[model samples]
Target: MAVAVNAAVTLPSSKTSSSPSIRFSSIAPERIAFSKGVGYLKNGLVTGGKAASIRAQVATETPTKVVKESKKDDEGVVVNKFKPKNPYIGTCLLNTKITADDAPGETWHMVFSTEGEVPYREGQSIGVIADGIDKNGKPHKLRLYSIASSALGDFGNSKTVSLCVKRLVYTNEQGEIVKGVCSNFLCDLKPGAGVQITGPVGKEMLMPKDPNATIVMLATGTGIAPFRSFLWKMFFEKHDDYKFNGLAWLFLGVPTSSSLLYKEEFDKMKEKAPENFRVDYAVSREQTNENGEKMYIQTRMAQYAEELWELLKKDNTYVYMCGLKGMEKGIDDIMVSLAARDGIDWLEYKRQLKKSEQWNVEVY
Candidate 1:
């Protein structure tokens, strides 16, 4: 089952000069109607209208499990035994956890682990099955979180995948706390609690197998997960044999330097792979420009438009992005502007890149 959440902001009639903003909750299982951005409850009671179909296919399919040796005899032959693996079992590995706060009420990073070999690619993510009940007496929900650790952190694909999680806190219709299910569960885990998990999903954010391809990574907030994996697979694993053909360019943005994830690791990479790795950090809420203005990744890209064009024109360059949904438009505009300057049509560049699998994105 799913629940639909809708939020809309309205000003007083006297102060209603500006347009309102509306957002939907992807977490819900039911369809909700917003009449002029106002939502009303209709639980099995029709409001003089037909309802949308509630039956829909979900893409995030869970892996099926099979039962093993449940009815084995002394000689190992079973008698009428056929059972699927239970869907509710998982292990706990990381007991003593660490918590760090970079944002006041927005994001928090939770570090934990589960026993067993959880192998995953550099760009994959895991779905967490949190164990707890909500205030409504419902079991806590499952959530997919991008793995932030490098492939090296996987310990030959047997270790845990470190996760960087963001907490979502909102108020309910009754002015009560409506916390995010998985985020708060992760944040509140004690030393011995267990967390069920499935995955290592996603294919679009993977690193290139060819060593000679250049990598351009664009990310914002916790979207840095896959790039961390890519970097480790390249530099940490020493995949650059004869000559590293790719120059790794990373463009990351956050509200402030303090909110930037993996700062220490990126700094270390800067010192080690100084020639191949280029980093540009856009701290939007602090450190104003010379004209006293804030900056973002798109703004920084504009500042380096010439170099960006050169890199994009490279023969085997791969561009990967994971971040907020609307930021892609800004990136597209910049790329189109550059394409126009280069005497090339925006559609040509877009189609060419799509044909070569050079353009990839994972936005939420």
Candidate 2:
């Protein structure tokens, strides 16, 4: 007998705008509609949306249990160890531009010296408070960024944390050049500069415990932060307790070849573990599909939809998406008909996967 469950998961609120709303149904599961943008699922609970902003609402009913259980399994996972009012003061160790000078925008890779004061996992995020007061006369709020280094840190000493940030500068309708406060502040930091840091927070994007699991990662631009942590742990570092023997396939989307983040590292990993690792890029500006269409991530993914669907059927396979909220709709468009051909409801199947902790998404 099959049991039907219907629930709604609210995402976290963001300063930017309203969070995405999610509702699950067994009878007639509607396509996930975003009030403003799409929401993200940590375990089974849909908390927030977007990669740049942290906007999650509360979970209700059975989804709440799923959140609790996921947290229980992550024993000793730190959260909010440093608050905005009393943040841990850390020093900048390195700040370098990872993108090309002529690329669409400036993206920076920065390392902060935690010195073991901040303990964080692979998929967690850290909040950064810029040193200034806002026009409202209050301190600038902390902005959360996904951790780009593994638990062992970039130097493998467990004494540092890293982040991949894109300097946000855009022109408003008034023709004024406005810069993102936190982003510009962090980007221009000198070595030894003090930083106010908060929370090694979030459990939604954590790596699976299975060493032999088939991990499929989809990321765009700076959203590759958490995936970098996972890949480093899987390929670069050696652990006595964990030895990964399964496959890790990554599908990265970017505007151009130069915009691809961590390309050299990913290429090295692919070279080192040819059998266990695979990577495909959707360089929208540089590539075109068979139909002569601009190759966005989904169009690139559609090329492997059959094979991907087959992998999705396996119990050990997990799918993780982290990037723009718009990517969700593109992925769904690819999977919907393929799932229908087999008389399966892709959304419901995805919900089941979420219930089993297999489908993890953290999109912005």
By lDDT, the best candidate is: 2
Q: Tally clashing residue pairs in candidate 1.
A: 6
Top candidate by TM-score? 2
Candidate 1 lDDT over 1-364, as tens digits, reads: 1123333433324444222333444423222222222221111100112110100111123323322121111232211121112222344322211123345354433334433345555677777767767689876556777876554343323344567666678888999987787877775554346776666566656665556677889898878878876765555443333235568899998887657766655666667679888899988887566666678777777778777766666435678888898778888787787667655665556655544456788889
- Badly placed stretches (over 4 Å) of model 2 are 1-72
- Candidate 1 clashing pairs? 2-28, 2-29, 3-28, 3-29, 4-28, 65-85
* Structure candidate 2, residue pairs in collision: 10-57, 11-47, 11-56, 11-57, 12-55, 12-56, 12-57, 50-363, 50-364, 51-364
Indicate the TM-score of model 2: 0.81
Q: What 10-residue stretch in candidate 2 is worst by lDDT?
A: 51-60
